[model samples]
Target: MNKRLVVLLGMSLVSSAAFAQSSVTLYGIIDDGLTWTSNQGGKSAVQMQGSISQGNRWGLKGAEDLGGGTSAIFRLENGFNVNTGTLSQGGRLFGRLAYVGLSNDHYGTFTLGRQGEAVGDYIGALSANGTLPGGILFPHPGDLDNNGIDFRLNNAVKYVSPTIAGLTGVAMYSFGGVPGDFNKNSAKSFALQYVGGSLQLVGAYTSIDHPATAVPEGVWTPNNTVNGNYGLAASSYKVLALAAAYTIGSARFTADWTHTQFGGLDPTLGAKINGHVTFNIAELVASYMVTPTLQLGAAYSYTQGNVSATGKSPHYNEVDASVDYLLSRATDVYASATYMRAGGGAVADLAPVLSPSSSQNQLALRLGIRKRF
Candidate 1:
């Protein structure tokens, strides 16, 4: 019975049977930067962008308790690419999240397998590519509506609740285990949140089916079209979101809104017509904390799209800023800038996940650093 002594005898039988309620942890984050792309292919470069602001990861989380208050949780996250170290959401090996659940601080929580949704968890952290210096080059233009940060979901099932009096709720479903194709690459989502006091609110909804055959598993084939991968390859994809935030004293204010839909549409991948395609987005963000280690942020986003049988519309407008600082308590340092414009007169192309900008305006700048554990 080897194999590292059967994993150290199963970790000493789980540390003597939850020796004082279990817990396991190991976390990570490491970001890098040195960007400046005012047109990479068209010339104007300065690379070394790894994990934009957050993306490189590491994980293993656990919980046990299982007593009156309930507990039994698990997580396994991993997403990498700290500049060539390799692996990142499209590379699996615990591509960002993997779950197992049971939680109850008065009844709530239930999970199982790959997650993240509910508008990137209750309104994508008030937007700005889901917070923290707007990483991944700031989405919107093809983030379609993951509201907070790019994709995730695979054969799932989730629920969250508990936080009454200030509200909270969530739900999810995912599956496309394929095999007779029950809704091809299925997915679903729902969310709601509120937090009184300094005020905060959220709302969410999502849908996906055949999102390029539902990504997952090293993400690379099929392409998940709709703009970057080239439009018109949607058999379904939907999203909706609403958000709000407030705080006075060191400042904070936010607003987010989203709407996306792209059903049917497969005009062989590039169409002048064939059906459905819609998008709408709005965002406003702000952050301030002059001292206390510095901090500053700003954002503005707007997107609009349409093609319902070719009424033709394409839009863009983005703005960003950041100044972060705080080189302690987990470290950080930043500087950012982003800009986009592509108003009217567009047959399609705003990309936004980088690349694209032969002229409707595009600019980016960054100076970054990060570390966490």
Candidate 2:
């Protein structure tokens, strides 16, 4: 009887060990709010927006312990509109993040699938505009610099090093997935960051070999001029950014600078359709915690766009402020406002009004609540 009991106990231990090796979790956030925008085509409009302070998302992440300090992991996250109950990120089911990889405590992690670039990962941490408050309105024109743009690259591989002495590094690559011309859609990025005490610093760079083309106005025709065989080498987009932040007590300050360049388009297209453009952006932000549950934040941004082919130089200045009140650990409410003024050549002519042109102004206000579970 004693021998039989020992054998059964050993079997139970083995089964429990196996169960501990693998686990999965489900998590998500829902954010919906009302917003009012003035000068949305010369008229003020009120609309419901999702993910105002944070992008509404649901995700599944899992890990398997392989023993000896090594593990396998994967994540699939999707963005959606809390107001309309629709998929965001260009209608992709897993538009935010989808990847699988392995990790070790002493080593690092390597993942492959749709993922964010290195620059976006590092620079995004430096700005309240990137994290809360301003949202997409504070991004540089076209989000060319990705300082809070949250642009995701499809068919990509990423690597993140374990933190060493308060420092971490990342590298990423994207495959265009285009057949017959593999290099045309390829992109590469690198970033390094350091965090110690109250200080943080980050630097990053990225390059694209062949970027996807954008459709022209009122026309469904393919505008592959940027990547088509007839256009320039198609690999002409580049970006670099530096950012730093310091925290003292309940107050924090941040500063960031970024530069971006785009080139190589089909000459047959109009001036707005082709040629080279450069954008430079700088911003300063500050935030103070009134209490654990209440905080106030503000920011100012300046952006300049220079066009090589069109002789246009436009500039934009913006101011943003917000107050957030935490209702509970899982829920919060906030009100924010942004005012922007644009000046320079033909800025008034750009459609969608998200790009550089002459004489453009906008004002926006949002009040909403968010809950996470």
Candidate 3:
């Protein structure tokens, strides 16, 4: 070969080697199903739904080796409705999750952008709401605790600690980015997790200020006007939760508790807010592996809301069950149902997941299939 050709070939080899350090992947899941509601707007109906078993999504994720045992990473995930081919999460293309950050094997992971809070990440995984079979309707009323992945924060900074002696720690904050006020719509969250043998535990806290001002990101305002019975906005919102799980052979048991407080509020949809609101929710869930390809799950949740503003203390109780048969490692067929009863509460909304029922009781059922790629 000529001298010039030899030099060009040598450069190509070097460039190819450098490119090997960076990798990208395209991934996604599709869940489609049909749902039957015993009561919807005082009318029973059957509807086609997407993401019933799991949210439909597609994304690009990549990692670039930066040396020193640290790497730069990015993820862009989207949510959509497979039934109608429409975008979920208010038309945002990459609404499910989007983030970029650095990862260190010995240190931890830190990322920035729109993402899930610590409660749903560290604690939710141990509950039925985060599982394949029970996720559709497993959340407490209104998904108040986000155990079912109802919301994500915008302009967020998140950090996760490396596991040490069966323990891991997490911290995160989301800046509202308002010009004159840094706390206008800011949010803060923290969590600690422990895993030992067949037992797991998690504790988490999240607080938000002026939740209504950041509506576009799907952050649930105290009143939840986006899709709730009463549109109330709170100046402050906070949630504290604890969860635990234990495994015995093929069966797992989980229990969780959450307390939420809403301070100072304005009504955007319903009666004027005259006082504050507090929510206490408790849940128990169970899952079992009947066989290598079959799994069964069940859950029960009780949520009581003390609406001090109106002295209308309402309570909701729910039960859910599901079964999934794996067609393959990455695919499954599933069915589930949720039944709920309400008393001393006029609001019967299932916001962030489904619409409110016209009556005090509601039953929803679904049959679906899911595939991951």
Candidate 4:
């Protein structure tokens, strides 16, 4: 009996030590709002909205120590609508993000599963829609350049380098998953980011083959839940983006540019010829902290698109302004106004809900609250 008691105590100590090396956490955010739009398919509209500042999400994350400054990590995140209690991302349970990875303090991190591309991960926050002053309505026309967190890559593998001299690098690739065609639906992306004091710079590039087939539920799909049928089908899609941000006292300024191309358009897009369409977009944003709990911000952006076959150029100009007040460490309330004007025979469109306007201008306003846990 004495020997058995000693053995049981030893086993209990080992189990406790192992348990101490592993941890799991639950986290989430909720955002809801009321919105008014100047035009939607030629009519004005008002509605209750969810995910104004950010998407509503609940997630679980865990890490297990493996000694030698290395660990295994995993995450599962879900997006939902607070209004109707339905899951976002086509009703998938863990559609927002799901990944498993290994991390090393010195060697960096490697991950696999559905994940964001480099452009949206590295440079998105420096753009208008990714900033605090902007929200779903402030994304570039149709979010053609993916400056917003609108999509993710499936069957992906990603690597993030450790910060060196205030700089970090990221690379990712997605498998086509086709039985015989290895590159038919593949995607590749790369990004670099540098942070120095109050200044930061980032750049990223992404190329996808057969985007529609690669990510059927992605933003490229016609009439997606977020953007309209702006990018229905293409043989390939590519994006290049760069951004810089600087802070001075209580003020912050940001600038960014992106180039997007839809190559080898399908007949559904009305591209009668065998050429591609391209868009060049640029933006500037500034924000100031009025008080410890209050902030104000404004931004401007311009987009130019060229149709190689028709020789037609369509353009859009947009302006945005916003104010935010903090209620507590985990909650905030905000209001925003966004307007866009279209030219060259293009209709105006706002993001996340509103449809394309019949005329050349569209405006959107929203008041919302967000809480994090």
Candidate 5:
């Protein structure tokens, strides 16, 4: 009996050691705010907004070591609204991210499921609107170029290369999942990034077929557009963007440019135009760390638009300013102000705000708190 007891105790120790090779974690963020708009459908108003600085979310992630410098990894992330307790991203349980993949030290990581495009992964890091201190209000008009990741791709297969000499590359493809048509609603994206010392650079490109059909709940949807009543129904959508950031002392500066196109529009399908439309946007951002727990940021952007069929051109200009104070490592308070002006008969609009201004100018102010765990 004594010998058998010793063997069983040894087996239990080995089992526990093996189990330590796998691990899982839960994490989330909650952000809520109050916003005052100078013009929302011709009236100045104040409202409660949730997830202004960061989207409210909870996520589970795990990894299992498989030996030989490889591991199996998975993540499931869900987005929700703090104000209404409703799910975000079209109400999908794990709409923000749902993926499983394998990571190898020597090779690269490969993943499959619904995921973000290369633009959001690579170039987004260097864009002001992609991160805190700038927040959602800093994005270009309509978020048309996806600098802040307005939508994600479904049925995607993604590859991320291991960093080599401070450079990394990423690619992704999303299948349309339409039984007979392979290209319909499909998407392809690529990105390259380099980070070294105080300077960072990135470039990304993405093309999607049938924007409205590919992402029904995304930016092209009627309710998702800047103005709730309008939608863009195009045969294809494309974006190309480049960005660079430099840090000096307690200050950082970023500059980025993006080009977006909506091609082959059908006027009968809720599209206002019979032909394509394109936009070119450029932005500059600067941020300064005033103290260990305080920061200030500002940005300016310009957008140019052209309609292929009407020979019409329009332009827009926007400015964003923000301040952040850290209450603790896991909590912070922030304030932001944004203003936009439109020219050439274009209406002033901002993303995530369902209404367009009655005039060609708009302004908004927000105060918010964010907590991460």
Candidate 6:
């Protein structure tokens, strides 16, 4: 009888252990906003913008406790347009993220699958563009810098080190998945960040080799010659960024600088097109909270691109401001506006209606609500 009792108790323990090893959760966010653009396609229009405050997404995340201070985790997230109920990120089911990895509190985590690049992860923290209307006006021209506007990569491997003395490091690589051209469309990036007290600092670099070829033929082509260098045969592009922020009480201030270059284009293409373009960006942002539910923020950015081809230089100055009201932990409303002016050769390439001379100006406004669950 005693033997039977021992066997039954052991079976019960095993069942409980199995149950504790696994768990799954569902999470999502829905955001929509009304936007007024001064010259979108040269026609003033009012439209609904999805994923304004945050990308509208639904995701499944799960973990299995593997014992010995380790866990197996995975995340599958999909982006969608709340305005039209269509898939975002070009219709991929898990366009935002799809990764599986092992984690331990002592070591860190290494994940494999689609993931975000270093520039998108590190420098994004210094800007408010990831939140609400900030992204609409503040994203780098064409979102070439990622910051917060661009999202994820495919076929990637990523590693994140445990924080040590307020410092952490991240690295990622994406496979091009092209036949006969192993390096084509591949990319890599790394970043290091330190957060201590009320100060934050970050530095990062990223390179992409032959990205344009990764797309289907006749779908899209790089219009800017500088981008062509990074898209064509045996070519690459690189970006370096440094950003810092300081916080005191309820107010925070941020400043950042970035330099980007494109190189290694086909010589024939380089001759017909600009071989290289060096660009610099500078930004300053400040935010304050009037109450637990109310906050105000403002930012300004300047960008200048030096032409290696010698026709003209492109420069832009933009200013942004917003006010946010938090109704609850998972819900908020905001009003925001931005004004931008382009000069030098910049306006020549803009929409004809908006660019009569080598200069252009624009204003945008948005009002929106968001909720997370």
- RMSD to true structure for each model, in Å: 18.9, 4.5, 2.6, 2.3, 2.0, 3.9
> Per-model C-alpha lDDT, please?
0.76, 0.72, 0.80, 0.85, 0.84, 0.72
Clashing pairs in 1: none
Among the numbered candidates, top lDDT falls to: 4
Range of the 10 consecutive residues with the lowest summed lDDT in candidate 4: 223-232
Q: TM-score per candidate, in order?
A: 0.33, 0.88, 0.92, 0.95, 0.95, 0.88
- Residue 132 of model 4, lDDT score: 68
lDDT of 1 by residue, 55-81 (tens): 779999998997899999999999888
Off by over 4 Å in 3: 1-14, 215-230, 268-271, 347-351
Give the worst 10-residue stretch by lDDT in candidate 3.
221-230
Model with the higher TM-score, candidate 1 or 4: 4
Candidate 3 achieves a global lDDT of 0.80
Worst 10 residues of 6 by lDDT: 348-357
The candidate with the higher TM-score, 3 or 6, is 3
lDDT of 2 by residue, 94-212 (tens): 98899999998988998998888766777866765565555655554445566554567778888999999999999888876668987766888999999999999999998876554
lDDT of 4 by residue, 1-373 (tens): 9999999999999889989999999999999988999999888999998876888999999999999999999999999999999999878899889999999999999999989898877777887787864587888887787777778888999999999999999999999988999998999999999999999999999999988878666556545311222344678999999999999999999999999988987666433445677889999999999998999999999999887766778889999999999999899999999999988767788775678877889998999999999
Worst 10-residue lDDT window, candidate 2: 215-224
Off by over 4 Å in 2: 1-9, 213-235, 267-273, 346-359
Pairs that collide, model 6: none
lDDT tens digits, residues 219-271, model 3? Answer: 34444632234445667778899999999999989998999876776655232
Q: Which stretches of candidate 6 lie over 4 Å from their true place?
A: 1-5, 131-133, 179-181, 214-234, 265-272, 348-359
Between prediction 5 and prediction 6, the one with superior lDDT is 5
Decoy 1 TM-score against native:
0.33
